[model samples]
Target: MRITTRRRLTRAGMYVLFFAVLAVVILVTDWGRLAQQFFQLDIARDQFPEIITIALKNTILFTLISFVGGLVLGIVFALMKLSSVAPYRWFATAYIELFRGLPALLTIFAMAYMVPIALGFRVPGGQVGAGLIGLILVASAYMAEVIRSGIQAVPKGQAEAARSLGMSPTRTMGWIVLPQGFRIIIPPLTNEFVLLLKDTSLLFIAGSTVLTKELTTFARDGLTNTGNGTTLVMAAMLYLLITIPLTRLVAVLERRLARGR
Candidate 1:
């Protein structure tokens, strides 16, 4: 057989395998039971204004505050990592690697509990605040690398032109380089926000009041109260509603970048 014929046969086999598995799943699933358990609109309705007002609001608030905090921290560290000063570079490198290597859960736990116990320091705003700080630490670690790469991606000539125009190094970075670097980084930074939004679910580790609860904690409590899976499904749907559009935007930005290039 020719190479194209062999490839065609392979593709046909894959389609057959895919549909066979899909058919098996469809046949095995009990649609009525699934809906009864997970699609209880009556129980879902009980979730009410609180889910939207309190849980989702807190989730969004946490994500925005952490993202903004992380962005600022990321910038400082990124600059430090690029500094001519050896100590600054070393400290930045250590911070990024250490946080990136640790689980966000552990960091949140430590911030919420251990810091207060060991250091005798109260993390401002209590457990929820500590969780946000932990998130900021982890996020900044990742964003620092993104920012450094973005800054480096700025054409050296742009900085050179600014310098030649008698701009100080700081002024060149501030006025000329950072604006372009941030533009180049917008897609990745948007992706980071999506990740942070999901990570807010991890704040469950830090505990919360009803008012402070985010989606995951709220949904877990609802699951207990309703004794049905509806609230969990609702939480999943809400997460999708928030994430899907952001994910689509990332793809669009990537495509636009490709086209521009």
Candidate 2:
């Protein structure tokens, strides 16, 4: 047989085997039990308005707060990392390495518990505040690297042109280089935002009031109260609802950036 014919036969066999496995799994699954556990309409209904009004709201709010705070601090750190001053560079490097090396869960736990104990004072908004601080720290470390790469990716010719036009170094970076860099980095930044959104689920480690609980906490509480996994399914759907669009947007931005390049 020709090589092409052999390859086609192999491909056909793989496709047939894949569908055969899928059919077997579908035939074996207890659809009724699965539906009762994960898709009970009544159990899901119990979570309705509060899930959207409180849980989803808090998730989005926390993500935005973390992203904004992280973006600001990340810019400062990126600049410090890029600075000619040795102390600034060293401090920035240490911070980035320390946070990036640690698990975000540990960082959040420490911020929520350790710092307050060490300082003999409470973080301003309580546990939520401390968790937010931790999220900002982790997000900043990652964003700083992203921003630094973006800054470095800006063409040296752009800076030279600005300097030739008598623009001060600071002014040139602030006005010209930074803008272009941000444009180049938008897709990555959007991806980071999506990550932060999911990370809000980790905030349950910090503890929360009924009003402050994000989706994971809310769904967990619902699971305890209702004894059905439907709440978890609902939460998963909501997460998909938010993340899928943002991820698609990231893809679109990346494609556009690729085309622009």
Candidate 3:
């Protein structure tokens, strides 16, 4: 009846219940069927070299392009959002709100199909280009807010110090505030990179040539050809291989930043 004894008994019961459920599930499951569907080594082998060289390569490439494009545009939008000029603030706000409110898939579809048709403009690299552009636009909207918060988080004293030392407002912001703000925001930015990496899977909606296909498309194609889930499993593993390290890096950066603070 003591509090500590009751707590230990409850914990032991929870553990027992968890194992009981797990044992029943394992007993009822068909290991042979599961292996045939998702763990067929021969089917998995067929996807080899190309899965890594082509599918995964394209995923990483698309992510890098989108992240770099987004970061540059995000910085510009963040600056505009903070600008003294009313029009700049208004435009930036409208853009951020619009993209943030829209589903990324819808935005990608529009970029790939609607915008080009309406404007009679061709996006270079065709569908792939438009998909990347859409990703950049969505990413910039989210990142603009991140960058804006980071910039605002910088101490006002740093800007005042720079101004007192004869730096112009622009110079102070560019040299002092922005750099310090970036340092403050590195952990979140790294986390954004991980999210963007996963987001590259959405590019399959825009369609791709075999050469440009990322992991999801590649796995789906493999599934169609092999009629096994192994390809999907392989693709999932590749995604984990890339994202797990980046996520761990984000945690490390956060801890380091906290220590610095």
Candidate 4:
């Protein structure tokens, strides 16, 4: 046989062996009992209303608020970082690096605990508000980088052409560069939003009221109440339900962008 044929057969045999072992393990394991306890529909149904109100609602709210906040700050920072102005560039650079260098959990904790103590003023939702602020801070840092890269990816020729047509720098950026840059960045930004959706789970550490609780907290509370993991499984499914459509959108955007390339 040819060497290529032999190699293909060897790879196929390895895959077959892997699946055979997987099948044996699944058959030997108590998966039925595991499913009965963890995937109990009655327990999930009992917890569904609270899960929808607190977990799903709050998770969506956090994501939208953080994304909007991050997007606004991200645009400002991206422009500043790209500017010829020294102080603006320095400030934007420092802000981006400072937040990006820290772990997100640390930022969330500090915002929740340290900010209130230092400012001597409490926000509306207390810990949850603080957590949302932290999410915005961290997300803005990442988004600033993404926006900067997108802006910079616009060809210098495009700017020059706009200038030659008597457009001011601000107008050129607004009318030409940003529109193209945003198109290029859309898929990655969508992926970032998906990440932000998942990262909202970290807010559980900041403490939440019953209505303010996100998916992780809701699931955890249910786990305690029922002594079963049904809620966790349900929450996982709900997250998948929310995320899967966005993921497909990202895939479509990526494909379209690739074709443009």
Which lDDT value does model 2 have at 41? 91
The lDDT for every candidate, in the order shown, is 0.95, 0.96, 0.95, 0.92
- Model 4 misplacement above 4 A: none
User: How big is the positional error of residue 81 in model 4, measured in Å on the Cα after superposition?
Assistant: 0.8
Worst 10 residues of 1 by lDDT: 252-261
Error of 2 at 25 (Å): 1.1
Per-residue C-alpha lDDT of model 1 across residues 139-227, encoded as one tens digit per residue: 99999999999999999999999999999999999999999899889899999999999999999999999799999999999989878
- Cα-lDDT of candidate 2: 0.96
TM-score of each: 0.97, 0.98, 0.98, 0.96
lDDT of 4 at 222: 90
Clashes of 4: 0
The 10 consecutive residues of candidate 3 with the worst lDDT sum are 40-49
Residue 253 of model 4 has an lDDT of 89
Clash pairs, candidate 4, are: none
Badly placed stretches (over 4 Å) of model 3 are none
Ranked by lDDT, the better of candidates 2 and 3 is: 2
For model 3, residues 124-167, the per-residue Cα lDDT tens digits are 99999999999999999999999999999998999999999999
Per-residue alpha-carbon lDDT of candidate 4 for residues 106-162, written as tens digits (9 for 90 to 100): 999999999899989886668999999999999999999999999889899999999
Candidate 4 minimal-lDDT segment of 10 residues:
45-54
